[model samples]
Target: MASSRGGSGAVGRANELEKMSIEQLKALKEQADMEVNLLQDSLSNIRTATSRLENATTALNDLSLCPQGLLLQTLSLSVWVPRKSKKL
Candidate 1:
């Protein structure tokens, strides 16, 4: 059940809208449309970021499963790390 406190219920909103002038209604509609657009754009960006993260994770998993020598060759590395400098 919906609460009617603070004039937040649908019936309360309808009564409020009924008291609003035409210009006020127009402005409210414009503001609502802008908010909807912003929300949709945010959703799209989140989905794209999620997809890119998934692809990167899958690629990392594939790389980890590759043969050790192949992995080293692909990285073109002769050693995992250079020997510590004797002077240090």
Candidate 2:
């Protein structure tokens, strides 16, 4: 068993890794790479969701500030129409 070190954990891990067989190291590397890919995918999804939420919030704010008469028209397009232009 490897002893746990606080700040020097990486050094301890390196030492332990040095004692591992080549096949063990290769398997470990494969598992680490898979985890990294999964983390990257999850992060990408989170970013996409955050962006969508921001866009929805901005749309809601814009709708809240719009004049009452244009509410129906705005909902139809789901976007803010220019206040100065009556054209769709």
Candidate 3:
């Protein structure tokens, strides 16, 4: 792939830096700095996406407990409420 070729090309350049002219070295350093910035931005986006997925999962789990809670409340009310007795 192109990415693999680019990775090897940078490794090859590392070995040839001493032979390069000052202008070429400066340009190479600038390119490397830009790549570092791009990778940092990508990592930040991934972290934000992961946090959002975790929050969504927690909300879904809480919603699933709602029915059980309502059933408990109804059962407790029926058991605790007393009926009036009729006189014979």
Candidate with top TM-score is 1
TM-score of each: 0.69, 0.68, 0.59
Model 1: colliding residue pairs? none
Against the hidden true structure, what lDDT does model 2 obtain? 0.80
* Tens digit of per-residue lDDT, candidate 3, span 1-88: 9999999999997879978999999999999999999999999999998998887788567657665423322235223222344569
* Per-residue lDDT of candidate 2, residues 1-88 (tens digit): 3545564798888899999999999999999999999999999999999998998998888778867766343435446465554677
lDDT of 3 at 27: 100
Identify the runs in model 1 with alpha carbons over 4 angstroms from their true place.
1-8, 69-88
* Candidate order by decreasing lDDT: 2, 3, 1
Tell me, what's the RMSD of every candidate? 8.0, 5.6, 11.3
Instruction: Quote the positional error of residue 6 for candidate 2 in Å.
Output: 3.0
Task: Give the alpha-carbon lDDT of every model.
Answer: 0.74, 0.80, 0.74
- In candidate 3 the C-alpha lDDT for residue 78 amounts to 20
| Candidate 1 minimal-lDDT segment of 10 residues | 73-82
